[model samples]
Target: MCENAAVTSTDGQQSPPPAPVVPLTDAWLVIPLFNEAQVVRGVIEEARRVFPLVVAVDDGSRDDSAAQAAAGGAVVVRHPLNLGQGAALQTGITYVLERTDANFVVTFDADGQHSVADAAAMVQAARDEDLAFVLGSRFLQGPSPVGWLKRLVLKTAAVAASHTTGMHLTDAHNGLRVIRRDAAARLDLRQNRMAHASEIIRQLGATGLPWREFPVHIAYTDYSKGKGQSLWNSINILVDLLFS
Candidate 1:
């Protein structure tokens, strides 16, 4: 279960002395940025427009991604060294738990694939279902823009995970997800790189955390497309699954 579970309201009000926690109006948006100095600012700006408290984790970028995110109104947490995506996410999550009062934690990619509106929708959906985890799916509603081979790999992995976990999710690798603080606390992120996506599915399967998937926009811009994992990355992910 998530250790950070607490009701928060948008208004900065609490119940009483020894204060009752007003449902958190604050949601911690954790964006793990690598060398994405170009797009990080826009992502942070969009996040700020929706969620007042957005935390951008700079994973030892060589560029000004950290400073740019800070300038764009995100609370930036910089790692002394590049530990990888999982570590960056963990850093941001832990910061939110310690520094601010947040009712939920939502993870987004620094790449421009995710939309701020979709993110806010994910949070609303979480509130309605009271679920611990929710994943974003690009394939659920229509054709995905990714190349056919990539789509094939993604679909296969999702199907395999669904069969393995008995949870029929169409998209398991999507980075856009909302986690209840308690559920997040329970996740042990061992994978340092791309495999973290698969690791999350495995952990949720083992923990039986209530989970669901919602369709979200994944804008495959020229920049995002260029930075996307190679078809070989999917192969490596599969190898990791077999061995893991």
Candidate 2:
């Protein structure tokens, strides 16, 4: 759970105690990395500023992503071979949940697109609301500057996920999220790639955990764009969902 961060006072009265600040010790920020050596260090350092406990799962990177993450003050977990993002996440989550005493877990992308500030806020919100999970949404404050084709593809995927899972999700594949230990324990992750995103939504909906999405801003730099999913991947995801 979250611990109160700061208190505020109003007109001659203190507002109902604000949400508690989540201690970094009690939360584990799980970053799934795959050859993101250039930015992974900075990302780890930045995340460490808000959450001290960071576990970077190096998914069999061909470069020094693991070393960079380790040097950046993260506990590095590695897969023997190159597994997909979901596998990397599972490796990290299982390690954190089983190895550490962390009460909560967060799945973040190593692509440097997710916001640490948004993640910190979500942790506080999760603790204050006693939610099982907090999902980040890019559409909460209106549309982001995403490309039209990307938007169409994502929306179509989101709609498919919503209908399949019976959950009204504005964004189903956002990588920023906070998952409490209890809820995380209930998850039976099977997918190993991008399809895992939809699998998570389905699991969350099936479990009926108290969950909500908060607005998060994603910075789409050249590096992230280069590593992002392609338009054709949407078709692949749909096919995988149906058959794989």
Candidate 3:
């Protein structure tokens, strides 16, 4: 949780990281799709512009999510049954680690809530800092618009997670993240549902992997809002955390 200013990439003295000379050939963007027919293709197409490899995990969606993702030129992987987002992410990461020569992987949202520019920054930051994981935080420096009650609940959950993980995170549930191959190898996420977020943080805290957070914008459109977690689901996440 503490920033080690002394360990930064320094050519001579304290300095910024050099430009990304290292090609991102093995770095893949993973988008877990669950009936996101309207925006899945668009997201994959845009992501392909920044990343050469894009892996979409179709989490047993009833709709044509897998077809649309394939049409968008992403390597589509399908689960015979509807697994949760966490399971889908694990499946996609495993696919890259085992199927390709990927050294890094990013878990991204398929609902068009995430931005490509921010994701690029995160990937660069992870490389520069030699970090295991880099998370995107809406509270970093952007205009995060959420309802008062929803905001309060989310904030409370984040605080509780920070206490549990000792990471002092600004946003705990953000889906935008980058994980290096080494870190991905270390991660063993058990939670298959929303609680997977907490599971990730807990594991990172236990392992004490070098982690950082960057600013990113999360657009809450009417469609995104409709697809977002309900209040009851949030409560269920808390309950799961308490028991597990």
Candidate 4:
């Protein structure tokens, strides 16, 4: 028998070693908060059920967002002044990219809409497919908690993004996403407004990032409906899209 082969008796009996079980660890869950002290705790709590590292960025919230987030067991990053959502998220991403050994990171809303379980699943899906980016969609699979006008606006924006960026994404503004370190590093989010959603699509196209789409649940509460983006904001987003 060769040295590499296991020795066997004349009766042809042989033994096999046990396979190793690899532990699961890579992704970090990030929640961006702007005066969302009411819902941030639950969001972080749910996120910790899956990801060991949960980061909450307090975007200059006048409320107790930073304290509450830290109390809820999340690594808290705060801004002295109120920055936009894109900037807050980018800050959190950059912090983790520099400070941790994270391979993937998820950008999730601080509101009570997103499911942490779904976020974990999205990370798993990204790992399985080896995707650079995974976007969560509310329209592709089933029902959404968004209002009619909001749905219409999102759909219209999705179409515009498709034409503008040559990408076939179902929902362009969903806040839930899984991103690889390389793709996140390549992203340059200059927009300080809602138009960053569209800019992200453009960046994905520009960088040729391998991305996929997955369905997720969104629970649009009365509070979220009240706090939803306005049509005027959509027009502003359009201007940003056109000019920037």
The best candidate by TM-score is: 2
Tens digit per residue, CA lDDT, model 4, 1-244: 5435565668998755333323336888778888988878877876676676888888999999898899889899989998898898889889889999899988888888887777878888888888899999998876776666667778888888889888897889888989889888888888768888887778877878688889999886776767754455556655665676
TM-score of each: 0.84, 0.86, 0.85, 0.84
Against the unseen true structure, what C-alpha lDDT does each candidate score? 0.80, 0.84, 0.82, 0.81
List per-candidate RMSD values in Å: 9.7, 5.5, 8.8, 9.5
Count of backbone clashes, every candidate in sequence:
13, 5, 0, 0
Q: Give the runs in model 1 whose Cα sits over 4 Å from its true position.
A: 1-24, 228-236, 242-244
Error of 2 at 26 (Å): 1.5
Instruction: Compose the digit string of candidate 3's lDDT tens values, residues 15-116.
Output: 544444343576899888899998889888878877868999999999999999999999999999988988998888898888887778899989888988
Best by lDDT: 2
Q: After superposition, how far is residue 220 of candidate 3 from its true place, in Å?
A: 1.1
What's model 4's lDDT at 122?
84
Cα lDDT of model 1 by residue, 1-244, tens digit? 3344454557966433343323335578899988888988887776676676888999999999998888888888888899989888878888878787677888998877887778788888888988888889998787777777777778888887888878888887888988887777777787877677877777776778777899898887888667665466677667766765
Error of 1 at 236 (Å): 4.5
Q: lDDT score, residue 155, model 2? A: 78
Q: Tell me the spans in candidate 3 whose CA falls farther than 4 Å from its real position.
A: 1-23, 228-236
lDDT over C-alpha atoms for residue 13 of model 3: 62
